[model samples]
Target: MSKRALISVSDKTGIVEFAGELVKLGWEIISTGGTKATLDTAEIPNVSVDDVTGFPEMMDGRVKTLHPLVHGALLGRRDLATHMEAMREHDIQPIDLVIVNLYPFKETLLAGGSYEEMIEKIDIGGPSMLRSAAKNHAFVTVLTDPTDYAQVLSELTENGETLFETRQQLAAKVFRLTASYDALIADYLGKEIHVTDPERTTLTYDVNQRLRYGENEHQAAVFYQTALPTSYSIAQSKQLNGKALSFNNIRDADAAIKIARDFTDAPTVVALKHMNPCGIGTAETIEQAWDYAFEADPVSIFGGIIVLNREVDAATAEKMHKIFLEIIIAPSYSDEALEILTMKKKNLRLLQLDFSQAEVSKKEMEYTGVLGGLLVQNQDVIVETPAEWTVATKTQPTATQFEALKFAWKAVKFVKSNGILVSNEHQTLGVGPGQTNRVGSVKLALEAAFDKPSALTENAVLASDAFFPFADNIDEIAKSGVKAIVQPGGSVRDQEVIDACDKYGIAMVFTGVRHFRH
Candidate 1:
């Protein structure tokens, strides 16, 4: 008996050559509509589905290959006597090879397609055929991706049949691809149905790349990307230079981008080390922002990653060239700037990301992996306005001090808890992160501020990640010459903290919302 191969696809990338290769192997080809046309145009011998199934496609080509003849051929059990008897009785020839891919539902939705058009693109017959072939992998070979075509052909040419292990692997890939396709459709329709909290929601991602190592050299990790792009996520960023990105580089660069995204009103620069922003600065130009950020903590930013909200020009690039940085991330860079930076340092990683094309992050979910499971939560992207704040001290903050307080507020939330941020106007003076106690963080911040006197410790403002449990942190802040402070006023010692602030002639405000980043 001659072997039979069924071919159907929405993506016709390698279908012609793939089917032609089957023809060269003496396997009879059975293809549907467009695939049959392609094989015909390529002068490949083929049998049309209508000829095999004895049924014409109907419902605008939606009913093709969905009949018992097509499925029975793919799902027949070659070893079972009863199944072989039924196949002979029904004159159903077993299909040895199946190649199929689904429709463009994801692409159609992303292209701003109409509801009817998107609905029409939801493939039924294609997935059904794939599932049938996958279910009978013990007696069949399945191919879903074009990248596997050459491998499958090589195996067939060498052995006269695909290996059992290769068939099982290809069958597994079919289910994975179909599962993702179904998930995209379900997610899209779930929104229209107003199913805010469906009992089960499906999301699928494909492996983007395998990294060198995880956070440490001992662990292994791989990056995955969503099938449907809903935002300009960092996973979609383009890396223009340097070696392959490690796990640590991705984490630190993500932290820098998150901070830079918050300052949409002006050009912002954030220098990060070990997932903490060491220095942050906002100015009218990228050059000034870089200058202020470098001045904020010249020592801490030695090997840090720098992220900018604006385009990097030649002037900013020249200044950056003088320093050794692990990475630089920005929306864009001028031709001259790119030349100077890449020419100056060969190993510096350059990443270009445009946040404007992204969806609002508040709608997305964040997941943290735990033992045997994951802890899922929403992102903390809420921005508190001045109208929501209350003054907590006897003396009100001056206009300049209040502006500095707000700047510090935004900066402190990104720090780890027990976190403290000290700033003077648009630039951060010092930052204290990952302390066990608030007073310890205060001491760390003040010491850092004192070390960089040019950051202006005299009237610097302090922002705490949470409520101060005692007035000791307040005393520590005053000792550093910080004249203004802002914290969530939920602690039992709020009045005591306020009294201590008044004793030091420091102004204070309560934002009402505590930013506790653990």
Candidate 2:
């Protein structure tokens, strides 16, 4: 018996050669409008659906393949007496192979299309034929993705027939293709037309890759997305170097971007360890930012990821080569900087992300795993500049101290909750973070300010991302000889905290905002 195959697609990749090979193997080629035209252009003899159905193609080529002759060939069972009898009465023969891809529904949405554009792109006869072919997978073979074409062709050439397993896999892909197509259409209609369709937002996506593991070795990890977009999703990146990304690497990189993105000034640097900013500072030059950040905590930033908001220069590159860091996420890197960095740390992950173009589109409510389920809450602990802040303190900070306070406030927001940071002139002296008590956090911040008056006066400016609910914390910080103070003053004892600052002659300014990250 001779084989029969049908080819119809909006994407005509590899279809002509595929049909030619099948025709050479004594298989009849059946196709639709543009598909048939393509086969004709290739000088491959083909039968159009109109010729098979004994009817003219009508309604702008939409009614060509919806006739009973086409579907009966796909749906009729080969074994049953009643099915065989009905097929003979209708002059129908079983279709052995089905090659089809739907209209450009997904592509239309991605191309900034409107409702009418999507509605027009939805394939009616294509889905009808696909479902007809996929449901009879035991008898009919279905092909949707062009990537599967070469595999199917190779299998047929090697064995002279496609395996049942191959047909099953293609059928599954057909369902997935149709399902994803509808999800895009529904999602678009819901957004633009406000179509209160309850079925719209339920999204389904394909897995792109699986990481080495999740947060722990015991857990499993898989990454997924609706589509591969250039600046968005991990799958879109070209992994130029480094080992596979762990869960912690992605999390810390995300934190690094959040802090580094906002600083468009001369040079801003942030060193992140375990999803918190271990050190951060801004300066008139990139080298200065690197110097200040390195001097902040040369110990804690040993294996942390560093993010620089400005292009790295040779001076900064020379400084970075001495440290053992995981990754350096920056906007760009000079040739001299690259040469220096690559020589020292060849395996280091160097990523040049578009800081100005990327941001979290929506505030994803954070989900932390618990015993039974998970804890969920909004993550908006980002701190802003002092110019937009309301100063509730009696004594205001000096102009120079105000800049240091804003820099500290921005960095501390990325730190763990109950965190504190102390800095002066764009360099952190000591940072106390993740401590339980407020006073403990204060001590952790000012613990390294020095015993000598010269060192204390030169590099001691205390900053709290929040307010001091009591004056005792102020007295202890004064003992560290913090020459200035900056906080979001909202406590009932704000006056007492102010009094302590006056007694020590410490300049204090409140931004009237608190940033607590947990």
Candidate 3:
């Protein structure tokens, strides 16, 4: 008896060649709808699925492949005597191979598809046949990706049959694809129908690129893109020039871009190292912002990533080329700027992205993979303003001091836990991040400011990502000549912290909001 292979796909990249090879190997082909027409057009011998079932397709082609003949052929166990007897009694031949791929639900959602259009795009029969075949992997070979065609054909040519291990691996891929496809559809419908929690939670990521290594050299890593579409994310960035991004490079780039987005009112610059902001500055002109930001930590900005909210000009590019940098990202670049920067170093990664539409999508749930399971929660996107703040100290901040306080509040969010940020009116003076204790972070930041006399520590204001535990942090800030502070004020010793601020004659404001990044 000649073996049979079911051929059905929405993506027809390599189907013709794949089917041709199978035909040359003496395998009977069964196809449905557009797939049948395609095989006929290519002059390949095939049996229409309608011919196998002896029934015309109904429900506008939706009912073509859902009949018992299709599923039974795929689900029948070749090793079971009873299953063989049942198949023989019904005159049904086993489907030895199943080639299937689902419809593009994700693509449709991104294309502004109508509700009705998207409803039609959700594939029913494709996933059904894939699951049936994958469930019976001991006897059937399944394929979902076009790239697997060559390997499958090669294996068949060598052994005259697909290997059991190959069948098992292909079966696993089918379930993965179908699960993600169903998850995408449910997420879309949940939004349309206003369902808070679907029956199951699903997140799918596609491998964007393979990195040389992870945070360390011995570990291997790869970058995967989430299903949601956003042009402002690092995945969508266009690399104008430079070496491929590594794990650390991508992490730093993401931190830099987020900080740059915080200061969209004017031209801003953020220089980051090891996932922490070393220098941040906002000014009327990008040139002045870069100068002030670089001056904030001239020693640490070496080989760091720099991001700006505006385009890069020739003068800025010339100054940037003087220093060793890992990456530079902006909205766009002047032709003269590109010519100068590209001419300076071939390994400098230059990226162009637009943050204008990043806020269009609502904040989605965030997840972290643990050793046993995943920890999921809503993203912390709560925004507050000075109008929603309280002046904890008797002395209110001056207008200039208030503006600098607001600037520091935004910049501090990007810093790691136990983080402290110091900034004068124009630029950041020092930043201490990832400390074990709040007082330790305060001391580090103060010492960083006084390291360079030009930092003007006496006139700077401090912002804390979280509330201070004791008055010790206040003592450290006052010793550095910082006269103002901003922090979330819900603490067991809030009065102690407030009394210390009053004792030092420092003005303080309680934002009633905390940002803790771990």
Candidate 4:
């Protein structure tokens, strides 16, 4: 009997040419339903799978390729006498190759398909055949990706058979494809029924890019993104100009975007370094916002990532061009602004994201990897309102001080744990993030606030990520000119801290919510 190859695919990319090449190589082709019709229309010689199985496709073509004949042809060991005898007894012709790509489940889910539509798009026979061929890779060749078609054909034409190593690699790819396919189905079904934590969890992501290094020059890294594009995400942003983003660039850009997204009420600019916000400013105009952010910390803004909630105008671009920024991300850019920024800076990455779709989806989750386990949690996208807070001090914040406190509260949420932020009404005066102790962070923030040529600490508000364990934090704040403060207010010594605030005539608010970014 002639060597037979099975071809079933939903993604018809390069399928006709591949099948025609196989036909020219004197190989028999077995196909089902749409694949057979496609090959027949292309005038490619092929045999229907129904003929091989001697059974008509039933139940809307779902039961076509799930027969023993297909499995025996794929799984039979050609080198074993017993296997060969069993195949002969059952009149099963060995299938030398399997080319199958699963149904469009991911695409359908992204397209907002209904539950019934998603269920119908899940491929059953395709995975079964691919797994059968992959498990018996010693005797069968399997292909799921279309990019492998040319190489597989070249090897078949030259060597008349795929190399053992090639077969093993292709088999591995098949298993990965099937596993990802099933994971998508499982995740979708789980979400449909509101199953937050299933007994078994599976996740999948597609490779976005391979970076030169991770956080350091000695480590390797690759970027992976979800199958569907996420709105207001750094991974979803389009690079308009400059060199490809590195690992550090991506991390800082993500931090900057997240911080910028929190201030949608006004034109906002966030300057980030080492995954922390160095300076954040909001104003009536984007240019003014840029000026406030740059003035917040001119020294730290150098070589940092900048994310803006508004379009980049020519004025803002000119000011941003003066600094050596690693990246500048905005919703859009004027023609002259893009020209001015791209002319002198060829290595500075320019990213454009759509801020219109900045709303957080309910299905979004965050994942972090540890030494031997993974931590999964809902994304911290919540923005608390001032109505849910309580005054904890005798002094009350004035109108301007209240707005400044609100800004500081939102800005501090993006900072690392033990975070302290000193700010006026519209700009961040200083930021101290990731300190070991609360008092240490307070001193760092106060020092940065007062170190400037024109100190920005007069009537500034302070925001801490978590509660102060001791009154020493308030004492440190008292040394500075900060007048108002915001914190979670959950420590056992909360009264002592409040008393320290009252001693200094500082107005404090308890949000009853903690924003720890560890």
After superposing candidate 3, which stretches have Cα over 4 Å from the reference?
196-200, 454-458
lDDT score of residue 34 within candidate 2: 90
Supply every candidate's count of residue pairs whose N, Cα or C atoms clash at under 3 angstroms: 0, 0, 0, 0
Cα-lDDT of candidate 4:
0.90
Model 4 CA deviation exceeding 4 Å by range: 361-363, 453-455
The runs of at least 3 residues in candidate 1 whose Cα sits more than 4 Å from the true structure, single-residue gaps closed, are: 358-362
Candidate that would win on lDDT: 4
lDDT of each: 0.87, 0.76, 0.89, 0.90
lDDT of predicted model 3: 0.89
lDDT of 4 by residue, 1-518 (tens): 67899999887899999999888989999998888999999999999999999999999877889988999999999899999999999898899999998889999999999999998999999999999999999989999989999999999999888988999999999888888889989988887889997888788888989998998999999998887778778788999999999998988887787788778998999999998898888899999999889888899999999999999999999999987999999999999999999987899899999888777633478888999888899878765779878999999999888888988999999889889999988999889999999888898888888886554666689999999999988888887878899999999999999999999999999999999998
Q: What local lDDT score does residue 470 receive in model 4, on the 0 to 100 scale?
A: 96
Which window of ten consecutive residues has the lowest lDDT sum in model 1? 357-366
lDDT of 2: 0.76
**Residue 233 displacement in candidate 1 (angstroms):** 2.9
Q: Given candidate 1, what's the lDDT at residue 319?
A: 92
Q: What is the TM-score of each candidate against the true structure?
A: 0.96, 0.81, 0.95, 0.98
Better of 2 and 3 by TM-score: 3
Enumerate residue pairs that collide in model 4. Answer: none
Ranking by lDDT: 4, 3, 1, 2
Per-residue lDDT, model 3, residue 462, is 91
